[model samples]
Target chain A: MYYALQILIPLGLLMLGWGVGTLLERAHYRRIHRREDQHHHVPVTTERQLWNPDLPIAESRLVRGQVVVSVDYFKRFLAALRTLFGGEIHSYSSLLDRGRREAILRMREQFPHADVILNLRFETSTISAGGGRAMGTIEVLAYGTGVRYAQALRPPAVPDPAAD
Target chain B: MITTNIETVPGRTILEHYGIVQGSTIRAKHVGRDIAAGLKNLVGGELRGYTELLQEARDEAFSRMVDQAQEMGANAVVNVRFATSSVTSGASEILCYGTAVLVE
Candidate 1:
């Protein structure tokens, strides 16, 4: 029974971690997609100035959003294992992508009415400590100058209830 | 003081610029928060404790940079940037640097 229990326990944990991690990632992506659609009006660009050059800016200021996401144990395990083979650890791709998009979305939410966001920059860093890569945390910070036009260029849309 | 990542603060004229000024701080999570973050790694989600702690540390670094700029007789900080690195187990450094300038 001890042997059976030992095998079953690790297997059970692996299954649980994999299941929950995928589900959480999917849910986060769903929310990201919905919010991306809802926030389509606000154009976030890397350029220093508005594309139109005729918006007549009323105000602009730096807006920033930051988030720290923890890597699930299952992914960390896979990543650690992958290190031996010395190949890509695909498990972390979506996590990094999610962090960037979420941070950008949060920045957009900070100034929803802005005509455009200019000069956007993304800063990302891993917060794994000295012991090993066993513990992983990803931090992404998105910042830009959100510009508000002097005059309304488009009809004001209804507020999104999904926005927080 | 106005702080921006862009080279120049919009709608403001740069009178003079002082070279780059910077501030840094190292923060270590308490035992409780560290344990909490470890448990959170079991599931995939945001680490609220680390988020708040890092942000708090970042703000403190920013404040120190502002203080330095203020002492240099600058009213605004431009081209601001933040970087983080793990210096040791449990302790990480938050560094903020920028150009200090007088703007009108």
Candidate 2:
């Protein structure tokens, strides 16, 4: 009975972790997609120069957002197995995508008035709480300069003939 | 104070350069948060606790860098950069640096 209990416990835990992990990942991806669609109008770019060079700059400030994501036990196990074979770890790809997208979304949400974000940069690192053997937490940080255009200098849609 | 990752602040003139100012902070995760993150790892999603932790650390580092700029009597910090690395199993360090400048 003792031996049977030990074998069953780990198996049960693995199964539970797998089920919950999949559900959470799906939900997170759904949220990320919805938010991305909502903020599609906000232009986020890595260009060193401003998107609209003609627009007069009113204010520019630094903005940043960060996200930390962890790999599930089941995925980690799979990743370990894949490591031995030395191939692409598909599970980790989604994990990184979620972190990066979430970080950018948070930064975008912070500055509604900004015309665009320029010089965007991303930094990622791993945080392992336990021994090196365990899967570590991954952190993604997205930062950029939020440039707000001068409202007073906004160009008119049509030329004013009377002024001319 | 004006802070930007860009090398120059648009529409502003830089008068004086104050060299590079930097700040860093190392943080360790609490047991409770670790356990929560562990559970989160099972499903594989965003770990809010760790996210908030890192955000706070970043903010602190930025503020410290700004304070250094203020000490140097600069009005802005340009070409700002951020980095992170794990010091140990649970602890990580957040570092921020920038070139301090007096702008008009």
Candidate 3:
């Protein structure tokens, strides 16, 4: 009876700690969400300034130059392996898309009139141990230059009143 | 500083400026197999923190590369590579780097 009690006591304490930790984390997450909702805003514009070429662009900028946007999260290494066999990149779609949009919005705020940005890039990397399931973090960063396209500025046309 | 596109070799002089770009992400799951494995770790073994650490390091290195690229007046970067090394039992570092060049 004493031996059973010794084992049960430690297990119970561990479970209690895990529960409390999870509750605290959930509360923190909710507060962050509320803050983000309150801060969301964007300006509306109708001028057709964007250039549309017949051919597709090789790259596009998400934001102005010298700016960096990052998103971080954690995952288990073993779960990553399962994703490989599934062969579907969709699992990461939402995370990447949201990061891209948020970064672009921030960039627009920084460079309101800039039209063209270049040298955009994207990359990913992983670090894992050979053990069972473990916890790890993921981070996403988006960056690019912001510039006004040259064509946007041109000399105004002169009126010929004599002909009228 | 002129931006160099990573597409071509630069003229005489070892360019010192650098540009950096990077991306990172993390995910978690409660699979039965993972649960069983964690249970076994009660005896002893490393966890999955390496994945998170590597992602963070990669982002940092990419940022540095972008900075260098911008200094060199490069418009883009290419031929990127990643490397990793163990800093300690509980920590590791991952790096992502590439060549910066000029493009038309």
Candidate 4:
């Protein structure tokens, strides 16, 4: 039973990982697409200077977003096998793309009304588990300064409804 | 206080500046969070617990830096920068620094 148990456990785990991981990734992508469409008006830029050098700014503040993603069991095993061939690992590419896009979306979500975001930066790090060669998890960080024009933050001059 | 990573604030001018101010915090996740994160590894998705933990730690560091800037009588902190490192197996350190300044 020992050898049977050993062989069956990994096989079961691989199946479970593939089934659930794909579902989660698909749901995450759907949510990301919807939110990205919702926030189209907010602009983002990596330029150090303000988009409009002379634009009046009533408020400017720092904002950031962060994400941490781990590879599923099936992908990790696949990556381990991939090392033998020494080629591009498509799984990791998508993993990193998701992390980066999610991080940026969260950053944009922080300031839905931001006129522009400037000096954008990113920081990524990997956390290895159990001293394994396979990457265990990756964290993506995105930061920037959000700018609001002089009147951007002000309430409309509409007369109060109570007064009406 | 307003914080920006760039040398200039959009509509404000720097009148005076105080040298670099810094804040640092070291944090570790609790056992419950660690266990939850481990389970997430099976299917490879976001580790929400760790995300929240790190976010809290970073916010703490940012606030501490802002407090220092306020104590220095500065209205803004510019050219802000952040760095992080894993000090130990489970604990991480977050560092935030910026130049404090009075802007008009």
Candidate 5:
């Protein structure tokens, strides 16, 4: 009876602590995710120009520019698995988005008065490094071409809605 | 890959002296999950090991590759390559690399 009581009592306490810890961690993660999501990012309205609103803006042999941005981060073991389960993807996404935006902003800084940036393309890639049991970290690369052009004045080029 | 080195002609710029970017990962599941995985292995189905392990190694290797590129004054890496090898029965390594180049 004494053994059962000792073991059961401690086990129950452990379970309770674990549950609370999990709850706190999850809350923390969620809070961070939310704050990150809410972070002052470029308003979506800015990206709309990249999309052809009326199929009028098409250009070829246009001025071309490119920018590349990358971020490397290592997460704790548990966070790595949480990523596979779709729990931690948002964090990475946010990080990538932030990086891309900064890159674009830099481009814009280069050419501040441009009306529209045509032929804008963004690419992201990841690679694995070591043969081990735990996932060490994640590296994200974002690259794109930033162009300045006027829709009506731009040349008639390929129209691929799927480009976006 | 982008390198700041001025290559007037043809010559190996040597982006990274190591000639490799490496990422390694190790994972042991949560206690309960480990027990479950061990038991499930008997049934011969998908195991969660790869998911976690690969993710980690990939990240580490990527960081290393970037570090190497940075050391070379590369602003960007192009033509990236990825290779994997099984280090042990249950462990693996994921290495990623690319050409570091300088963009004008």
Candidate 6:
């Protein structure tokens, strides 16, 4: 009975993690899609220069956002199994996607007055927890210069409805 | 002081270039936060503690880089860039670098 209990406990935890993790990931993806759609007008670019070169810069500031996401036990378990086979571990992809999108959204939220974000870039790192070699959490950071063009340089378009 | 990732700050002229200035820091979370992060991993969500940890590290690196630019008698830093890497199991390094320049 003792041995059976030990097996049952870990199995139960794995199932629970799998179920809850899937639900959470789906919800996060949905939220990311909605936010991306809402902020579609806020052009994000990796180019070091602003979109309109003639536009004079009224204000420019560095804006950054970081998000740390962890993998559920079940996904980690799958990843571990994949490691043995030496194949792409698909389970971790969503974790990175969520982290990146969340970080970008947060950075955009910081600059309510900025018209666009230029030179956008992303940085990712693994944070190991519990002193284990396995990556326990993944951190994604998005940063860029938020630029607000001078009034004379403001683009002649319908003001972004989403803009405050 | 003016700081920008672009080579030149719009509407400003670069009068003198003072070469590159950089700063870096390695940081790790406390044991409590590490344990919390481990538990948080079970359900798979954002670990706020780790996020805060990296943010603090980046801020520190940025300030230190700015300080170096100031010491060089530069009023601005241009072409700024940030890099982050995991140095060890628990520790991560954040580096900020840029060219120090006197601008007007």
RMSD of each: 5.1, 4.9, 12.7, 6.6, 14.0, 3.8
B-chain TM-scores per prediction: 0.94, 0.97, 0.50, 0.97, 0.59, 0.95
lDDT of 5 by residue, A77-154 (tens): 234557668654543453454445543454344434344443343433332232343322222222222333444354
lDDT of 3 at A53: 31
Comparing 1 and 2 on TM-score, the stronger one? 2
What docking class should model 6 receive? medium
Q: Is candidate 4 or candidate 6 better by lDDT?
A: 4
**TM-score for the A-chain in each candidate structure:** 0.84, 0.86, 0.35, 0.86, 0.36, 0.88
Predictions' DockQ, in order: 0.58, 0.75, 0.08, 0.60, 0.05, 0.67
lDDT of each candidate versus the true structure? 0.82, 0.85, 0.40, 0.84, 0.40, 0.83
Q: Specify the highest-TM-score model's number.
A: 4
- The TM-score values for the models, in the order shown, are 0.85, 0.90, 0.35, 0.91, 0.31, 0.89
Q: Pick the candidate with the highest DockQ.
A: 2
| CA error at residue B85 for candidate 2, angstroms | 2.3
State the weakest 10-residue window (summed lDDT) of model 6 chain B: B4-13
- Which of candidates 1 and 5 reaches a greater DockQ? 1
Candidate 2 segments exceeding 4 Å error? A134-136, A152-164
Candidate 6, residues B1-104, lDDT tens digits: the string is 78777788766679999999999999877889877887778889888887888888988999999999999999989888899877776777899999999987
Best by lDDT: 2
Deviation from native of the Cα of residue B77 in model 2, angstroms: 0.6
What TM-score applies to chain A of candidate 2?
Answer: 0.86
Candidate 1: regions farther than 4 A off: A52-56, A154-164
**What lDDT tens digits, residue by residue, belong to model 2 across residues A63-139?**
88888888787788788889899989997888898889999999988887677788999998877767654564688
Residue pair clashes in candidate 2 = A21-B43, A128-B89
* Reference-based TM-score, model 3: 0.35
Give the clashing pairs for model 1.
none
